[model samples]
Structure formats: C-alpha cells, structure tokens
Target chain A: MFEYPALFAVAAVVREGSFERAAHVLNITPSAVSQRIRLLEERIGAVLIVRGQPCTPTEEGRKICRHVERVAMLEQELRAVMPSLGGEEALESRITLPIATNADSLATWFLDAAMGAAKRQGFLLDLSVEDQDHTATGLRRGEVLAAVTTLEKPIPGCDSTPLGSLRYRATASPEFLERYFADGVNARTLAQAPGIVFGKKDTLQYQWVRRAVGHDVAFPTHWLPSTHGYVEVSLGGMGWGMNPALLVGSLLEKGALVELIPGLCVDVPLFWQARRLSSALLDELSGAVVKAARASLLWTGAGR
Target chain B: MFEYPALFAVAAVVREGSFERAAHVLNITPSAVSQRIRLLEERIGAVLIVRGQPCTPTEEGRKICRHVERVAMLEQELRAVMPSLGGEEALESRITLPIATNADSLATWFLDAAMGAAKRQGFLLDLSVEDQDHTATGLRRGEVLAAVTTLEKPIPGCDSTPLGSLRYRATASPEFLERYFADGVNARTLAQAPGIVFGKKDTLQYQWVRRAVGHDVAFPTHWLPSTHGYVEVSLGGMGWGMNPALLVGSLLEKGALVELIPGLCVDVPLFWQARRLSSALLDELSGAVVKAARASLLWTGAGR
Candidate 1:
C-alpha cells in the first residue's frame, strides 16, 4: 500500500516547487520532507523529484501527484458529510485545484467561473496558461486536473463537455487596412504585409488566412504574446491580427478597428475536460465553467 | 567555412517550430529544408533539431541558433550601409528579435518600446514572458537576444542597464480588508487571510508579506496568471495582492482599493539586459526600452 503521508509530501513538493517551501506549507522540517521523499522513492524504485533551484517532478512524480490531488478532493468531500471527522482545522485547509486554460478565456470569461468556484467551495486555484490547442497536453501528462481545450473528444479516463465557440475577427486599424490592403487583401498583398501572431504555437492567424485566401501565404509577422497587447498593437497600426470579438467589440463599433475581411469570422469551439472522478467539488467547478462559457460564447444555429 | 544557408535553415526551423513551416517561410521545399538541417548536423557532429509536433532545438542547436541570429543582425547592418548589396528584397526582409520579459512589464511599459523598434527598423519582435526574477535564464541559455530582469548584475556576455524600479503596493478592496483584517494586520492575521499570486514562480506577495510581518507566514493563494486578472480579482474583493502602483493608482485615489499598510511598498528594481552585440539595431531597441522604462517606472528618492 502507498504511504498517504509520503504521497502528500510528494504532492506538496511538486506544487510548491521546493522542499523548503513544501515543508513550510506542510508544517514540517525540510529534512523531514527530504526523508519522506527518499522513503517514497525507495518503495517506488524511481527518482520522482529532480532537486534544483526550484524542484520539478519527473513523469513518475506527476502521476503520484495526480493521485494525491484526487484523494485530497475526496477527503474534502468526506469531511463535508461528517463534520466531526476532522473539525475546523480540516475545513480551513484549502485545497488547490490546478487547471489549464487559454489566455483569451482567462482575459474574458474564465475568471468569473473561477471566482464563483472559489467562493462557493473555498478552493484555491493554480491555473496554467497555454495555447488552447495545446492545453490538452497538461491533462494527458496529469499536470492539471481540468482544462479549457479545443479538442472535441475526451482523453481516456476524462470527460469532455462542449463549451461554445470563441469568435475571432481578422481585425486591423483603419490606417493599417489602408496602408497594407490598399491594393486589396490577396495572396500578393498578404505576402508583403506584416501580421501579428500570439506566439509560435498560435496558428489562429494562419488558420484565418487559409480560410480567407484559400491557401497558405508566407508573411512577415510580429509575435506579441500578450492578449491585450494584440488589441493595442492592432489599434496602433503595428500589424493586422486575429483579435477576439469580445475584446474588440467597442473598438470595432468606434471604428478604431476594422475587419480585414468583413463578415468573415473564425469560431473556435472549446471544451472543458476533467478526470471522471466522482467528487462533488470537481463537478461544481465543471458546472460553473460550463455555465460561464455558455453565457459568453456563441452557440451555432440555436442562438446569436 | 560554415554554411550560412544551412545556419539560416536551423534558425528558421527553430523559430517556426516545424520543418514544413520553415520551408514555407524560406520559400523552399520541405525536402530541401530537411537536407540543409541534416548536412548542418553532420558537419557539427551533434543533433540540432528534435523532430516532433513542434520541433525544438537541442542545447548545441540553441548555441548555433544564437550565432545565426547575431549574424543576421550584423548582415542587416552591412546591407544598410551598402544599399546596393541586396537592395529592396534585403530591406524588406524583416528580422525577428526574440526577447524575454516579465508579464507586468510587458503589460505596462514594454509594448511601446517593442512597437517603436518594430516601426523604426522594420523589425519583428518574438517575446517570451517569464517571471522578472527568472527572465535572465533565457539570456543565459542564448534563447533570447534581450530580457527585462530584476538582476542588477549583468550576465557574462550581456550588458545590463538599470530600468528603474516597478513599485508594488499590497492592496485589496475595502471590503476585503475589513473582512480579513478586522482587528489588525500582523503575522497571525496574514497567516489566515488568503492572497493572490501571479503563479508558482511569483514571489512578490511573499516578499511583501515577509516585510510586513517580519517572518514567513503560511497562507492560501489564488494563482491567477494574468496581469489584468490581478487588478480585476483585487477589485472584486477576492483577495489581497501585491499590485503595481501604475495599475491601482486611480483605484486607490477613488477609494475603490486601499493599501494593507499605507506607507509600505516593495520596489523591485528592473534592468534591461541584452547581448553585447555591436549592432545598431540592438542599440536602437535598448535605447527605446530604457526610454520607456524611465518614463514610466519609479526612480527611488531622486524623483516622485
């Protein structure tokens, strides 16, 4: 049988990213934390933690950390049913739910759901931000409990629910449109104009271009990774980029920003995927996320 | 002699993160791109690119990529002087400068400098956001040409210029302060009250708390990784956090947010670090960054 105490130590180390910080959180000595990890490693016959300036978990450690997190969630649920099991200290011990999400969602609508979950359940959140297309990798690696992703299908041992599409417009300032697309936005013009990309992982601009022009076009790009920076740079006529509709609504109305191609939008469908664990807290979080997403995102054929 | 074309191919593959994408950017066939990479690897006697969904550079590959980037900058300068050497196509070829910076700096002051550099020199910026304390890692690894960092000392081959301090105040909504610190602000109260942290790597809140309380205190934290989210959450009465003065100045003046302790502020001194390359473009970028930082950040006792 696995040692629950040692498992907790492993989880704390990974979460805090250091033995000393984990010790402080666990209310134990650093040496004691090291000994517990050593004992756990001997039993498992593998090096779980890679000690460094900020310690990191190996693949084996990540699996163990995931197990401990689920166990903690279950324990919290049990204590809720029987208050006499642990008392006030147990209630005050906050559980952190590590989740992965895209930056645009966090900037627009995800925080309301997160704040609601935290207030309702007294849960702390450890959010990992990644590109929407790549957020599923965290779930696959057992690094995050839940994720906002672009994958319609669920990974094995996980549940997937459809969150509506986040609409994006190929937006540019009036000056930018006039300066670059004066001759019109075709393959020739696009190849010469500068575009804004979120990062190397982001393909939103490429995807939108392929849809608009019917083929890939090589263009010069300024890679600015901030979501808000995208809007600001576009407004400054730095480059044309795919800006989220929700963020650019007022600008578009004010005529500060214009669509490179009017009436053409990209609707990227998102999903909330979480482990299929029978815990009320996880279900509550999933419910809050789905509710927020449904309220803000566009639903096809059924609603505007 | 080293092959310049093959080196450019290595840099492109790493920048684009896929051989096919590199080929598209270089206007070459995929097989031709592959051939260049293989020949470079054979000559170097080490693996350069790790083939995957998105290709990455090995350690040896990073060194070579850095070399190619510097060469590109120098070549651009040479063509600038001798206009007849390459002419329109050369002037049109936009060179990307990969830079590392903290999110707070990027959100506040860095974008202006980035936009300025891009406009003046026809450069493209590839920005990587990391914690201020850790931004220097990219410079040390030769992954980025420049970085905004908290380290006062320069990295071995880099030049560091003081960019003034980004002052932060421990702030919360009036309701939050009343609810959590009804009696007073001390280690005892701080240990029970929740805090907002940017991420696991963020230690700003901890540093502020240690200064306020005179010792380490264990507290629950909501790890929201967005700079704008920090202000929103603090305004929503979610938790107290170390917020940049620039963001919360109006809120403080309007009585929406209050400092935990009125006069205690943490001043994180920032510096601009870049490779000590003799390129005019690098110098122009540095001048722009230093100018922006001076205009926005605090300069300690000498200025308000």
Candidate 2:
C-alpha cells in the first residue's frame, strides 16, 4: 500500500477510464498502467476492475478508490495546515457546528455547506436530527455547537439568525380529497379526513388547519414516515399532505394533485443558531445556510 | 495512542487501584505499563492520569479509555465473526441499529445491554428518545431494529415480549407537599396542585392526577429537561412529580423524599420489540436483552 509508484499507477488507470487514456494521464506508456493494475490485483488477491469497453470498478476497486480519495484529501489538508503549527505554544483551534436537517438535505446541501466552509477553516459539523421541529434540542444539550431550527426562540446559549421560511402546500389527489372531504373541507370535518404526516409532532397540516379554521385537533393520519415517501404517497392520492413547494412545483403544474386551499400554506421559518462564542467556522457555515435558504424559500417570513 | 500495548490499560489500573495489579491482569511487567502510559501521554500530548498510590483516570484519559474500549470491543467482535475474510469482505457486515429509549434507561440498563450485546456480536447501537409512550414510531421508520417501550402492542411486522411493569409514584418533597397541600393531602387536592412533567407529551403524572381527581386540568410546570434532574427537582421540593420506582428507591429508603400516594402507582408494562427476521446477530442480541431484563426488571411471566 505504501508503494507510491504502484498506488499512483492504479489511480491513474481508474481516473483515465482506459489503459490508453491512463498512459496519457500519467504521461507514461500504456503498458505501465496495465502492468501496475495487474500487480495491484495480484498483491491484493482480488480483481479490482471488470475489463470492458469503458472499464468499470468492481466492489473492491470502489472501496479502494474511496479510501484513496479520502487519504489524498486528508494529506492535502494536513499539508495546508502544517505551517500554522510552527509554534508549540500556539492554541489549536477547531470549531464544532451542529445542524439538524432532514434526510434529503443531509444527502445533498449539508455536504455542500461543509465543503464550502472547510475551504476557509478547520471545523467539524456534528449533525443529528430527530425532526425539523426538535433539532434545537441538540443545541440545548450542548451536543452541537450550532443548529438549524424551526423554533423562533433561541436555545439558552445560542444566537438565532433567520435563514428563511420553508413553504409547504396542502396537496392531495383529487380523487382522495373528493372521497374523504366531499362535504366541503373544514377543520371539524377534516379531523376525520385521512391525511399523511412526515413524523409524529410534525404539524404542518394541523397548523394549516388551525390558520384556515380555528381549532386544535390531532389530524387523522397515516404516518408515511419519511420526507420522500410522504410526498410519494400524497402524489399517489393515499391522503392529503403537506408537500414542500420545491418538490411539488412540477407536479402541481402537471395537475397531478390539487392544493386543498390556495395561499393557506404554512411557512416554517428556519433559523441558524450558534453558540454565543465568536467562531469563524460557524460564521462561514451560517452564511452558506442563509444563502441556500434564500434561494430555496419563499421569504415571506409569515411565521417569523 | 499506538504506543500503548493494548487499549484499557488505564481502565485496568483504575479498576484494580495499582499498577502492579493492573499489570498482573494484563500479563505485562509493571514497568511496561508505566512506559506505555508515558508513551501514550507523549503521543496524545496530554496528561492522562494523576500518579498516586491509588489510580485515577484524568478527564482526558477517561474519554480516550471510553473510545479505546468501544473500538477494541468492535475489533474483537469483527475478528470473531469474519476471521478469514479478505480485506474486502471484512467491511461488509458493519450495521448500525437505531433505538429509542428514555433517559433513565439510557443512563442505566440500556447502555449495559447494548455494550454486552456488542461484545457478543459485532454491531453498533444508535440511540434516540421519544419518552415511553411514543417509542413505537421509531419502529415504523425501520429506524431501530428494536426498542424498550411502555407500549405492550407490537408494531406491525415486529414481535414483542413483555419485560414487566415499570411502576411510577406521585411524590413531592415533604416541604413542597406541606406548602401546596396544607389540608393533609387527599386525592382531590393533589390534582389541583402544580406539577412537574418530563416533557409536553409525558402523561404519567396527568394520568395519576386524573385517577385521583376525576377531571383534567393544566398545572404549572418547570421543565428541567432531563430525567435525573426532573427527579432531583421533585425531591428538592420544586413541585409534585411522578418518579420511577427504579430511580427513586434509594431516596425513598433514605428518607430524602416521600411517596405522596402509597399504593397509587402507575404500572407501565414495558416490552422489547424487534423486527421478525432470521438474522443470527439480532437473535443473539434480543435474547441477551431478555436475559438482562429478567435480572433487572419486575418479571411477570413464565417464572412467575
């Protein structure tokens, strides 16, 4: 593994797609890439690549490439920070930020923000989530150094910045709504009307009902149990549910579903709350989240 | 960190109270333990222990020992299961089991059960909380493989074994009881008195009050937001609260707190439910949990 020439040879083949292109990438003979890959597979006692026109990575090769890429990034980062550790007395500073986000955000925007922030500072993001509403509890426990929350009030030791409002529309299949709420949709009537919810304590529809018709009641629900699946079910007309505007915009345009009540949507105003301490990493991340929120949300700030 | 011959060297020293004893347990010379400690400190660049006749792990040492013990246990279990795997196959079986549990159990029996199970089999436990009533929702997401819950009914596609009742008592600090209920406390007066709750959805005290008073009404509260802290506040005369029998036994016997309603206890039958699967690892773990539960809980079946 420590043989740099051998490791680089295999990496070049993987990057360049084929033995011919690998030679170009490495500025070496094609035979070198082929020979190196052969030696690596023999040493490891496993096939690393599936020989084909385009050349595909085997499961083993994918693992190796992942490890290689991580090692490369870590080494580069270490080298970049090595100069700052010149003095023994220097304080080693690392800021930890915590964010509570849904699964979709975790698989996408969260990583983007982390990469964007890491360019300027050495930081760790401690992300944990129960749901959108309860994400602030991590901040209260001091488990996270910062958080993105739906709560307006700041957790005791943190400062709050309004990121933006997440707009949600009450949508359902026309067939399902017609079957369930045929007697004209009202709060008392919709109490028995079947609906789908993201999770327990997720009250987007309840809040919508309260605003449209003054009442506080547990909406009858089939807990679909995920951000993605809830939208899928609502599209499937299993029940009426709150769909994030971004996900449903195209669907609404296509007349796949009808909004239960137009302009009676709920705006969950998200905030970035960080510890009172002045932290450069937290500031950088806060900026990125605010930018993302602005681009994604309607920004009416009705809830705020 | 690598300089230490093995993990848990400091833990052995602390548990045994001497370097010689620790060395005997580890099958190494005392001088080797001392040298390892010195080298470990040098590597981490922090003082880990206070040198004394008896042993004590420093705050930093405790953290490292904890991390070392977890990793060591994981490594041992991994090797035990996949002894002859090539590097590729060795990484395949790492699975994380999510669980929902209340704070008291999390700090006590749950951690012990998880660690013991992990020692017997290689797996990771990720824990979250939803109080006693709502733990079932965790199962709906396929988030947790199993949970310790008050709900007796099994979630769909899961099996539940009754772990016995967790009895809770309505108690107050002697002073607070005297102050709030001066009419020599009876059922009716207790309901109207201010109460302390674990959270918004925690209905233990409310149910007890309803049984006592025959009506529902809001009582003032101070949310300490921790299970142990809530019990402590109740004992300190903050307000009337429901205390778990497992948690408050010592305090009751020591005369630090009083049970306001003797024989008027809420018996919540807890259950251990897991997905019905043919996996050997989950089978062993669920069985171990039942065994541990028998030893620690109020068992009510088979042996009864």
Candidate 3:
C-alpha cells in the first residue's frame, strides 16, 4: 500500500472529479485529501490532478492511475493464492482479472475458456470486448492481463501461445444473395452490394471479397459491430459478412443464412498473449484458453 | 489509383490470405498477383504481407490497408456529393460513416444525433461503442470521422466543440442496496460489496464510492461492457453502478433501480471532435450532433 498509496488518492480524485469527493470516499476531510495529494505531488514532483469542474489527470497522473490499477489487481491476486496474507483484514477473496477479447470469440467460445479457468481456479473474469485486431492494444497498455489477438508475434515482455484460428465463412440471407449476386460475384457487383462489417477495424469482409472476387473493392457497408448484431443483420437481409463458424450454426441449419461462397473460408489464427509471469492463475488461464480454442477454432496452425 | 494501385492488390492478398485466392477472385493467374505484390514491395521499399499458412500483413501493410479504407470512404463521400464524378459507373449512394461514441451516450442520446444527421443527409451510421474515457483514441487513429469524447482538448488536426455533459447517478437494485449497504457504506463494506462496471475503463462506480464513502475502494465487480448490459446487470442485483440519467428512466420510476446517493450526480463533459475539413456532410453532421446534445445533455458549460 505504501508503494502506491498516492495512486489510490489520484485514482479516486480522477474518478470522483474532486478532492472533496475523494475525501468523502476515503472517509477523510477534504483538507486531508488535499494534503495527501499535495504530499504525493511533492514526492512525485508532478501535479497529479487538475482541480476542475470534473478533475482530470495529467499524463503522469494517468500513468500512476494505471499503475494503481495494476497493483490493486496484483494485491488481490496475491491474496487469492495466499489466504493468510489478507485473512482477517479482508473478509472475502475477490480478484478480478480483466481480459480483452474479440466480439466473435465472446459470442462463440471465449466464455467457455473463461468459465473453465474460473471454475478450476477461482477469479472473477472482467472481459473487455475489443476487435481481435486491436485487443493487443489493451494488453500493451496494461489495461488487460491477457488477450485473444490475431498477431502471430508476441508483444514485448509477454508470452504468445498459438490458440488455433477462428473460422469465418462468407454468409448472407438467401434473398440477399439471390438479388445481389444474381449475375455472380464480381468487383462491380461487390462495389454496389451492401455489406455487413464488424467495425472500421474489421477486415474480414474485405478478406472475404478478396477470396470471392480476387480483388479489393469497396461496397456500401453496414457496420453491425456486435457479434449477435452482425449475425442478425446478415439474416435480416441487410447485408452479407464473414461470420464465425459456430454462430452461423443454427441459422445455417434453418437456411436463414446462405453461405455466399462455399468451401472458401477465411481463417483468422488467434493467439493467447499474456505476461510471462510465474503465476499459477495465468498458467491455468493459458491452458484453459488453449483447450477451448482447440476444441472450437479451426486447426490451421499447430496450437501449443 | 496510381498513388496506391498495388496497395489494392496488397490488401487483396492480405485479405484473401494468399496470392492464389486473390488471383482467383481477380480472375487472373496467381503468378500475376505475386508479380504485382513483388513490384508493389519494390515501390514501397517494405515487405507488406508475410506469406504463411494464412497470410498476414506487416505493420507497413496495415498502414496501407487503413489508408485504402480511408480512401474508399472519402471516395464514397466524393461520389455522394458529385454524383457525376462516377456518372453511370456507380448508382446506389450508401455511405457508412464510422463514428465512435461512449456506451451511455449511444444508449441514451447519440443515436438521435446519428438519426438526425442521417435523415437530413443520407448516410449509414457505423457506431463504434467505446467508453467516454477513451473515445479519443478512435478519433486519433482516423477509425471514426467523429467521436463523442470527454476530452476538452482536440486531437491534432481535429476540431473540438463542447457537446454538454452526460449526467449519471449512483444506482443499484433495491435488493442489492439493502443487502450491501444495510450495515452502512464504509470502506470495509465497499471493499466487499459486489459491483457492476461497464469495463475496466469505467471509473463511475469508484466515483460513487468517493461520493458515498468519501474514499477510494475496490469491490468485487462484474464487467458487462455494453450500455444496456450495464443497466440490466445493475438491475439484476449483481451489483451497483452509476447509471446514465435517461437510461434508468422507467426502471427508476418502477423502483427497479434505486439511487444510492440522493442528489449527488457526476456530470461527464463531452465534446464532438472531428477532422477540420470543409465538407458539407461533416457540417450537417456537426449541426445534428450539437442539436441532439443540446436537447438531451446538461448545459454545464457554455456550449460555444
């Protein structure tokens, strides 16, 4: 606590937006919160928070807030394994590990891995949903402990393990395909057809185009960023997209969504990236994630 | 096309995951795609895609892909304004504008902004839901044309205008409040009480702690990450959270969610940040956004 005591105050001020309010939360007088901030600023040689309508953190202060979050997470982590550590002082062990994952994975298989890990080794899972292409950013910022990413290479100071590939196939409602692709898939038709995309960061639809039409072409796109929304929109005949293999199951069986291009699928190989820590919980997480991915995702590469 | 002709090819190869598939889509020989890629690499002086089990793009390649996407978007914008630019080449005028918005805003008032903009001027709203604390990242990356962000300062090469503040109050299901705060909300109780959070980035719950207990404390929290989910989770009695004013409407009336603190509310100031470009479409968008915010958001500061 001494190592990062000021950080809690700084975080409180940033979160609460004022010293007085932070004091209220800490059960101290506003002056005490101010004194602690003053002492902390003097110690750190930087003004941590701007006293404004809603207080904001300086760049340095933000770094401290992030550090505080990390340390608090670790402290809970420590108490989780070593119960005697915070025993009487802490009534119950509550450790939340925030992990970044893709929307597709969340709808399909990510939770199974999370639940498996939680059941075997108890820890609350706080999932932060970001596109697979960008989930690594959260990991880099220490905003998340682990991530499901498409990047093959490991982030610096992190361990990367292959976690199989999330399979996607070009799909749309039969009515949509019948109307739009009546003349067959081509650059001109693709350029005019409405397409469903995950978001700006999503490249799967474009990849589908390259595989189906053999060129990169832009079309009128409908961005249904959520996994379920993407599927629902595709089924509603709004547009077509590359949907996760598992999510299309019931729809495919019911013939609600027709595969635009059969046998031609895109494979986005995923990897579990985590800090190279000698923590049993992380090790358990890695195993659970790998197991789930292997069971669900396509085997394009060796997942070890 | 000449500036980045081969870029389209490179993007195709990356998307298709192989030169052969890209060639197939293009109705050309695989060798042709390979040759174009080689020439493009020579021109850029950087290797773009790594040929692999499933091909992937390098950092330089990703930048090129992003550039292609931006160019495509701008092209659509251009064709929208000057229909004769493409003349008979293109017909349907469906342009999707990617915009980043905080979840609370997205659920409460941002859609009206989007709808107002869309109705007056035709365009598709590709809304990317990010927390208010971090929406600026999307703006900086050019992933979104505009964003509803908390930062008062504008990103470089972007214009910033205050859009008013989103007011939120600490709320929980009556049962949750009764169970957790029955003994009174002190640091001890807060540390053990279950909490609901939007994501790791969400600090409103902590702000509530600062307001209620007068200090910084951590609680066992469930992360829902979506706007509706945040309310649903809080109402489900999983825990307590600070909810946006309008989102808790009927639930508040019905006592589904009870305010933990009676009048104390946090006002998160928002700003509309967009590229400093002279485009009528952008102007229309700005007007609609400001209009919507004014009608819904609190006038904490002089908007101008």
Name the lDDT value of residue A174 in candidate 2: 78
* Candidate 1 accuracy as TM-score: 0.96
Docking category for candidate 3? Answer: incorrect
Higher-scoring candidate on DockQ, 1 or 3 = 1
Model 1 pairs whose backbones collide: none
lDDT of 1 by residue, A209-291 (tens): 89989998878878888899888899988899999999999999999999999989998999999988897888999999999
Better structure of 1 and 3 per lDDT: 1
Off by over 4 Å in 2: A1-304, B1-93, B186-188, B302-304
* TM-score of decoy 3: 0.61
- Candidate 1: docking tier: medium
The Cα error of candidate 3 at residue A300, in Å, is 5.4
Runs off by more than 4 Å, candidate 3: A1-3, A7-96, A112-127, A284-288, A299-304, B1-122, B130-191, B199-224, B227-304
Q: What lDDT score goes with residue A163 in model 1? A: 88
Off by over 4 Å in 1: A87-92, A301-304, B87-92, B301-304
The candidate that achieves the highest TM-score relative to the unseen native structure: 1
